[model samples]
Target: MASCSNSNELLSELVCSVCLELFQDAATLECGHSFCKSCLDRKWDSEKNSICPKCRALISERKYMRNNVLSNMADRAREMQIKGETNEKTQIKPSDLSQRAEVGNTDHFCKEHSEKLKLFCKEDETPICYTCVDSLKHCGHNFIPLHDAVSIYKEKLTEAKFPLETHLNEIEELQEKQMQRISEVNDQTKAMELHIKSEFATLHAFLQNKEQQLIQKLREEKERTLKEMEENLRCIKEFSDTIQTQMHDIQSWLEQNDALHILQNITAIENLLTRSQKNFIKSSPKLVKHGITLGVYKGPLQYGIWKEMLSVINPGLTSITFDPNTAHPNLELCEDFTRVKNSGIYQRPLTDSPEQFSLCACVLGLEAFTTGRHYWEVEVGQNNSVWDVGVTQASSNRRGNIQISPKNGYWTVSLRQGILYTASDSACEALSAKPQKMGVYLDYEGGQVSFYDAGDMVHLYTFTCEFNEKLHPYFYPGLKGSAPLKLFHLCL
Candidate 1:
């Protein structure tokens, strides 16, 4: 009777003190206290420093969203309150409370046989009546007294939930880190793009200057060649006039005087014409064209720029190969171990190793990194309905069906049933878009790993983590579908 009264008394705590009724849109404060969202907002609006109603802790702001955990508790509280009110309206007396308390004592009795459920069947994981234990369902199954089972399972539950709070804190920290790294990567990529544009502008300016210099030098050489030809033309005109004058004089001597006069001047005229022919032959210039040939530089300008850009992009692509020792028996590697898919045949290889995955269709990269940045792309074709790609610690478990998450030595994003997911401890968060091919970027010293659309900078997810061991690029081929995941040797 005393316990029943105390149980009824504890129900009042869920009510908002200001409203003196159930909370509507419940939200919790940081100080482990909760109130109706409207009530808290009103309280802060009426006051200047907006402190907690129960405790004088300074409320950060008047605006707040509904607390999901508290809202769930509020729903249960409302149901309890309604049930209690219904009981009151039914005209229950004080003596009825005592009867209800007494009824709970026999609540464990089996309904069909009216026998006390004193034993627990381990096989069925259920409490059963002693007669039921002897019946067909539990004829020879392991049984424990109800009290013993309660004591045993309660301790196990407690032990299992012991790390729940710590794990929650860790998950919260990881989520925070994941968000921070995403923002950083976005910012870094934007800054890098701007830097690239600035650098190309500078190169373009330099090339333009070089082009003008080449044109100017070509023009000067052309003018020099033309000036020499112009001087030769002046000399040739003067020599031609003199030859004509000499011809006229010889003709006059032939007409006016006699054969003796013509004969005497013929030698001098012949000498003059011969000298003119020799000079013209010796100084004759041939026509030829000259200009800058830009075939090599012009053809490879884009390719040259890309090669120079690689230096700034840093460790863009290191060829990835499967570590054969770590491949699961059901998985097969092709394209020089740069492509992986599941094989229907599950026979273990003759040269067996413990690094092989026993359950998952997984493979690891031959190259492991403890420091530096790396970028790689995977051609995740539309062949599989599910796939996981990311990096994992060298010492990660390969023998069991473990949760592949950051805390469990994996930092991966997954595609399952057309939804993209970034792994966390409890559940994966869905991404906005799905990608066919994915790009992975890792900065070991910065403790960052990021995923993006291989075709564009559409970031999917990122994880920030400090490593204590070497990490290898990890791949999970869809076991049932067996779609190939191909590694790209070139940066996108």
Candidate 2:
């Protein structure tokens, strides 16, 4: 900073006043004013009197002589300014070295006592002078040599660093997953936007209202999903920032070696480290399940959304509860019609209710599927026991043992001995995979019923038949089955 100021001051002296440039063919006029020889000559040629161009000072003669002494001074000033700048940047000032050296001067005396910091008080975690070691403040504290204390703390610091670094790596991995989720959201929203616009184009002139409605729904979903994800991302970012701050503090503390200051701050660092080691990897952003309902776009434009909804949209997931009036004696109906488990002994029929299942340990959902596409999922938790689950004709036989097949008005699948069995008139096809959550999709018009592994949408089986009777979702918690089957939470 000082070098720049001096350079400007020197340059001002070297420059010719009239031209504002370095002296060229430099000469002095009789008025003791310096100007370039050509400038003086141009003034004499253009003017009627021998007057200075800058102040209009009268000169004794029209002739001007070259000042060799003043010219040399100007040349030297420019050279010195350049060298001064170069040296200022490359060479360290004495005061700067002194200032920097003061910070790392641990080997020196204590700031308070002005005596050598030879002893380290372990309890306080700081270096102290001999006077401090003997003082009442450190009466019961254990003291060690400065060098030994530093060595011990360094090892401890190294031990702490390994786990923090591992946690840092996990935080990075979580950040990466967060980004992937963001990209998935972006991709899904883009596809939805394009699909909506294209579908609207097909119905261009007739259904502008419907088009705007669908597009508006798309915008709402985009905003809602992104808002949730951004909030999650923000949480992860806040956690990351906290980890970084703690890391920096620990590093600074480790480098300082000031036992007194270290003692004052060590507790915070330890607490931070303990917190960081646990729960370092937070919940990253994930796409909301059933975030948007398709009814907004689907009611008016059925065909366009139906096929797409099959894969992307969770449509018409009706909330289904078991009907106690239809439960068999052996089957225990849980509260809220969500779960069922089999008991060993079968109780006698409570009443002559026609809706009750008299023979089998099977039950029916409260609502019957009369029309439209309906979807629902049941949690068929892990077990090797026999269990039956699917849709059944509402008026199907509930009296005696019957083959659970389409011909018997039961379009269903059974799990027996770790194998999946779909019943038909021909024979049951053995399924390879066992699903925890069973998804059932019923299309009354298509006259089709299909099942899936709800978690991944892996197809299990499809039953083809013409439905003339009202259908109800069915379940058979077999006598030998141990685990309870639960209906998944579906929208109202």
Candidate 3:
């Protein structure tokens, strides 16, 4: 019985009465008994009671606080065993200990100054040591405690990492999508390149054809102009020879007036001179005429006809009628077909139409000129309402008159007191009253009439009028008369 009793005590001491283990996660119960926390939890769960398993003492869950003191004592004992300093006295409770074992020892040193970095330089945005801070270079710079800087950096690091993390994830997803988009774009570009090449080829071919046609047309026009110029030169030379021969004959007859046949020869010479003059006048080259047929281009020789074809090309030729009573006296028509007026002088109203006028000029007899196509341009306007002027023949006039029109604005280029046919086939109508300064520009050369805005400054229109008449008036009255009527000359 004594052996059995000794064996029971040994067993009781070996195993924890509460845990029934070799004392792991050891904790002391309020009843002065010790147990493993897991084992006690297991016991409580199984029995639905908070009583100490070994003593059967009634205890509340509140009494089950972790036994940190015992846990520290156990930790110290384990650590001492690891260090080969095992001792029973080292197993002291955490509550009785004043120090803890060092944990996870690591080293950090400053790269510069070779000393520990203890502060952060706010200006340089770097960590520094006492030596660096006290240096002359850093004397005036701001600094913060390393610990404080670290805390701030930690917060910043968290913030910075959030965006970086999000961007990294987005980059991964976008890389795949980007590859797809690149492939699509490449395919579209290839198709577009091929299409552009095809269009270029077509355009090149079309341009080549147009170039050929233009060359041919230019050659024809050149030949026509050259031929007309040659004829004119020949006519001029023949007239000069005839005049020289007549003058020589007259001189010879005057010297031989004493001859008996002089009387008969003189009469015959007079008759011959009259006949020669008549022939010269009759044989003079007729004024060459030209006209335009406005048409839209469809293909070569194929054109779309706009019923009311408006000429927007060049329309600077104008005709104006002046009333001597209202016209400025200083304005005079020059022999060379230009109106000479005082620079700043304002002439009377060329037309009675509200005393307001805008210049519109036209070639009256384009067919009389050898030139096939006539072109002219004008510049008008002072302020915002200004527009570049242009003129071109809208159509050919078979009635010995050229139809001229304006391109920029509405202008009247009509004959003063003269009759004008409505169209090529229309009958002529007389201008009983003075029409709006129709179809004529101010004759700056004649000094007769001047054009102006409400401000009354010279606003001249430039133009070219081609006709057999060398002395062509820049301004022609909208009406025609049996007697010669005075007109203004275009300056340009």
lDDT of 3 by residue, 28-82 (tens): 7676667778888888888867876644677866276566666665555456546
Which of the two candidates, 1 or 2, achieves a greater lDDT against the reference?
Answer: 2
In model 2, which runs have C-alpha deviations exceeding 4 angstroms?
1-107, 111-113, 193-207, 252-492
Which tens-of-lDDT digit does each residue in 1-492 have in candidate 2? Answer: 566445444444455655555677788877667887877887688888987664456787675789887688766654555577435543333233323233234345554443567888888877788767756678899998877776776667667777777767777777777777777777766765665676566546656765777688678877887788777778777777777777776687678855645544556666755765654455433333333333332222333333344653444544578888888877776667788877755644655776788777788888888777677788887663677889899878877676787878898888777777787633344545678777777778757677766756555677767888799989987765568788853421
- Residue 90 local lDDT, model 3: 29
Residue-wise C-alpha lDDT for candidate 1, range 235-303, written one tens digit per residue: 444444444454454344334332222222444544544543453355432222212121211122222
Ranked by TM-score, top first: 2, 1, 3
Ranked by TM-score, the better of candidates 1 and 2 is 2
TM-score quality measure for candidate 1: 0.38
Residue 68 in model 3: shift from native, Å? Answer: 99
Candidate 3: residue 240 lDDT (0-100): 47
lDDT of 1 at 27: 77
